[model samples]
Target: MKLYPIESGNFKLDGGAMFGVVPKPLWQRTNPADANNMIDIAARCLLIEDGDRLILIDTGMGNKQSEKFFGYYYLWGDHSIDKSLAAHGFHRDDITDVFMTHLHFDHCGGSVQWNKNRTGYEPAFKNAHFWSNADHWKWATEPNRRERASFLKENILPMEESGQLKFTGLPENHILENSALGFDIFFADGHTDKQMIPMIHYKGKTICFMADLLPTVGHLPMPFVMGYDTRPLLTLDEKELFLNKAADQELFLFLEHDAHNEIITVKHTEKGVRLKDTFTTQEIFN
Candidate 1:
């Protein structure tokens, strides 16, 4: 199996909301924000080439939204879905599976694209089976007030409409076996309902996609949970359990939102879960 980081690009998000109760001074050091207090975040997706399947995880925010719609996030950088796919000798249609961690726009927007006529939408991956649990799919389709803005119908509805949407077993199962990503998916509910964090065992090393569970190294502490999480206390429990497990197994955490750090490992220091060491993506794969 081979894994490639498909960096779609970087975008800005409110640092305060991202860092939760953590003070700006602390988070700003790792994820420096702009004048408007919006920190740059990488819409970093992962591509897995396992056996005969080429799977893409969490398509970045696609370029379909209107200028006014994208104005809010301030998307930047030259990296794009097409460019990144080409870098790995793949294309949009090459994807056999679109493994969404969740259905938020930034996470799944790139799964569909604006059609040539610019009149409507179509599946970005023409031949891919998009995967998300049944419960999360339902929750995103009928989004609540807080998440309604994030779960755009245009970015989601097209999957089912295309007849390629499939569920990943039961909602209660945190550990999903035989994932399309070719890893064991550990589910977390705090971030959003049934968000799957892919725990991959490559060679003798374990690499985990820390989705929004731990957005940046700044979020290493349990309490630095995102304000966007539905249940912050549940996040605390999830983080406590997950991090400890990662530490015990020596898993390298691949940060999905951190603008700089690609991967890190943590330890149970006197100050709680502190970063033990850091490494680049190449260091692990090389």
Candidate 2:
């Protein structure tokens, strides 16, 4: 199996929102914000080549958003989703599966794109079977008020409209129980309803895609939850349990939103779980 780190681009998000109750004084050291209190974050995606399956996890924010919409996020960076995939000798159509961790614009916006003269939206990967669990699919499609702005119809509806959208069943039996994609869908509700965190069995280790659960290396601490989370108290409990298991099993967390760090390992310290070390996905196979 081969894994490629596909960097869609970088964008700015309010640091206060990213670091919940954690004061600016604490988060500023790790990710300094501008005068507007916006911090840069990487919308990194993952592409896995396992035999005949070419699976892509997340799509990052696409280019369809209006200038006014993008003015807030400030989508800066030269790397694009297509460019990053081409770096590994792949293309959009070459992807067989698009495993979306969630349907937030930054995570799955690139799943669709403009057809001709920006008339209609079309699945970005015409041949790929777009993957999302039934529960999460419903949650994202029928988003609540707090998350409605983040779940854009342009980023999602096209897949189902194109007849390429399929979902892994909810209440998945024993993880991979007839899942649409290959990996086990570990569900967590702290960030969003039934967010599917892929537990990929790759290269002799379990690599967990730390979606919003662990947005960045700085979010390793239990209290460093995102304000975007619907339930911050639940996030703390989930993080503690999740981090302890990660430390126990020595798993490499593949970070999606971390600007600088790609992957990291955690260790149980007297002061609670702390980052043990950092490494790239390429370093893991080596």
Candidate 3:
């Protein structure tokens, strides 16, 4: 199997919101904020080419949103799914499965796009089956007040409406082994209800897609949960358990939201699990 790190786009978000109650004095050291208190974030999606299937994990924030809507996030950079795919000599049509870690606009927004006529929305990848679990599908569709803003209908409903939406089986335990997408899925709930973190076995190593569960290296600390998380306490437990295991097993974490650090590994230190090292896709994959 071959893997590619797809650069969907880059944007800036309030560092305070990203690091939750963690004071700026601490998080700013790792994720330094700009003058406006905004920190750089990347919608780094992953593409896996295995045999007949080309599966894409997460399709960053698409370009369909209005300028006013996007202005809030401070979009930056020229990277787009099209350009990134072309870099790997592929296109949207080549994706057979679009497995989303969650339904947040920044995670799955690129799955749907405005149709040619501009009359309505359509599946962005005409040939791909959009993947989400039943629990998350309901959570996002019937979002609570706190998360309603992040789960936009324009970025979601079109996949189901187009008859291309598929659901992955929720595991009874935290880890679902041998999923339909050909990888183990680590189901996490602290960030959102039933957020699926893909544990991909590739190139003789396990690359865990660290979605919002661990947004950036700055979030490695136990209490450094995002304010957006509905259950911050639960996030602490999940992160502790996951990071401990990651350190013990020497797993490579494929960060989706870290603009600068692409892949990382953790080690057991006196202060608990901490960042051991970071690597670009070229260093790890090639």
Candidate 4:
């Protein structure tokens, strides 16, 4: 199996929102903010090429939203899914599965796009089966007031409307091993309901797709949870458990939202689990 880090796009978000109650004085050291208090963010997706299946983990926020809508996020950078795919000698059509960690616009928005006529939305990857779990599908479709803004209908619904949506089985425990996508899925809830973190066994190491569970190295501290998370307390528990295990097992964390740090590993520090080392996808994959 081969894995490629797909650079979907980059944007800036309020550092305060990204780091929750954690004071700027602390988080700013690792994730320095600009004059506007915005921090650089990346929509880093993962592509898996295994035998006949080419599975994409997440497609960054697509370009279908209006300028006014995107103005809030302060989008940046020249990287795009198309350009990144081309660099790897592939295209969206070659993708057989699009496994989303969650339904947030920034994560799964690129799964659907405007049709040629611009009359309506259509599946971005014509040949790919969009993946989500039954629990998350329901939660996202019927979002609560707090998360309603992040779960946009335009970014979703089209996959099911196109008859290409598929659901992964929810595990009874924290993990579902040997999933249909050919990896173990670690179910996390603190960030959102049924947020599936893919634990992929590749190249003699476990490369975990750390979705919002651990956005950036700045979020390594125990209390550094996102304000967007509905259950911040639960997030603390989940992160402690996951990070401890990650440190013990020496898992290579494939960060999806960290614009600068691509892959990282943690080790047990006196202050608890802390960043041990960092690596680019090329360094680890090649």
Candidate 5:
């Protein structure tokens, strides 16, 4: 199996929102803020070429939103999914499965795009079976007031409407129980309801996709949780459990939202679970 890092693009978000209640002095040291106080974020996706299936985990924010809509996020970058795919001799059509960690716009917005006629939306990956669990599908479709803004209908409804959506049964624990997908899923609820974190076994190494549960190296601390999460207290407990296990097992963490650091590993320290080493995906995968 071969794994590729597909960088979609970068955008800016309020550092305060990203770091939650963590003080600016503390977070700014790692994720420095701009004059506007927004921190850089990447919509980095992962592509796995395993036999006949070319699985893509998370599609970054697409270019269908209006300028006014995008201005809020301050999107910036020259890289795109198409360019990144071409770098690896692949295209959207080559993807057989599009595994979404969650339905947030930054994570799954590129799953659909405007049709040629501009009359209706269509699945971006024409040949891919879009994956989302029943619980997350419902949570995103019928979003609560706090998360409603992040779950846009334009970015989501088209996948189900196109008849390409598939639902995976939630795992009883962190085990791959009858899951059609090749990877084991770690179901987390603190970030959002049933956000599936993929635990992929590749080349004698276990790589865990750190979605929103652990956005960046800055978020390694247990108290550093996102404010966007509905339940911050629950996030603390979940991070503690996941980080401890990651440190003990010596797993490589594939970060989805970290713009600068691509992959990282953690170690149990006197303070807590802290970052051990950083590497480009190629360093480990190659």
Candidate 6:
């Protein structure tokens, strides 16, 4: 199996919203913000080439939104899925599965795109089966007021409309066994209902995709949780348990939202789980 870091693009998000109650002085040290207090954010996606299946985890926010709509996020960078795929000698048609961690715009917005005539939306990956659990699908489709803005219909509805949307077993099941993809998904509810974090066993290493569970090295501390999380206390407990186990097992964490640090590992310190090391995908995987 081979894994590639597909950087779709970069954008800026309010540091305060990203860090929650963590003081600006503390988070700024790791993810320094701009003059307007917005920090750099990356729509980093993962591509898995396992045998006949090419699985894509999280399609970063696509370029279909209007300028006014994207103005809020302060989009930046030239890296795109097409360019990244071409670098790997692959194309969007090669994708057999689109495993979404959640349905947030920044995470799964690229799943659908405007058609040729701009008449309506269509599945971005024409040959892929979009993977999303029943619970998350419902939660995103019928979003609550707090999360409604993040779950855009243009980013989601087309998956099902295309007749390629598939559920990965029951959301309650801790591990959704996808033997074909060579990964068992671990579900977390704190970030959003039924957020599936893929636990991939590759090349004698277990690579856990840290999709919002641990955004960056700055979020290593137990108290540093995102304000966007619906249940912050649950996130604290989940992070504690997940990090401790990850440290004990010496697992590699593949960060999604961290613009600078690609991958990181945690260690058990007196202050609880802390960043041990950070490396790019090539540095470790290659």
Clashes of each: 0, 0, 0, 0, 0, 0
In order, what lDDT does every prediction score?
0.88, 0.87, 0.95, 0.95, 0.92, 0.90
What is the per-residue lDDT of model 4 for residues 1-286, given as tens digits with 9 covering 90 to 100? 9999999999999999999999999999999999999999999999999999999999999899999988999999899999999999999999999999999999999999999999999999999999999999999999999999999998889999989999999999899999999999999999999999999998899999999999999999999999889999999999999999999999999999999999999999899999999999999887
In candidate 3, the residue pairs with backbone N, CA or C atoms under 3 Å apart (3 or more residues apart, or in different chains) clash, namely: none
* Residue lDDT tens for model 5, 198-253: 98899999988999999988999999999899889989988999999999999999
lDDT of 4: 0.95
lDDT accuracy of residue 25 in candidate 2: 95
- Measured against the true structure, the TM-scores of the candidates, in listed sequence, are 0.97, 0.96, 0.99, 0.99, 0.98, 0.97
Local accuracy of candidate 1 as per-residue lDDT tens digits, 134-181: 889999999999899999999999999999999877534568776645
What stretches of model 6 exceed 4 Å from their correct place?
171-173, 177-180
Query: Which residue pairs show collisions in model 5?
Result: none
Give candidate 5 regions above 4 Å deviation: 174-178
What CA RMSD would you report for each candidate?
1.3, 1.6, 0.6, 0.6, 1.0, 1.2
Candidate 2 residues lying further than 4 Å off, grouped into runs, are: 172-178
Q: Residue by residue across 112-171, what tens digits does model 6's lDDT show?
A: 999999999999999999999888999999999999999999999999998999987763
What is the alpha-carbon lDDT of model 1 when measured against the actual structure? 0.88
Give residue 55's lDDT in candidate 4 (0 to 100). 97
Query: Once model 4 is optimally superposed onto the true structure by TM-score, how far is the C-alpha of residue 112 displaced, in angstroms?
Result: 0.5
**Model 6 RMSD to the real structure?**
1.2
Better of 2 and 6 by TM-score: 6
lDDT of 4 at 47: 93
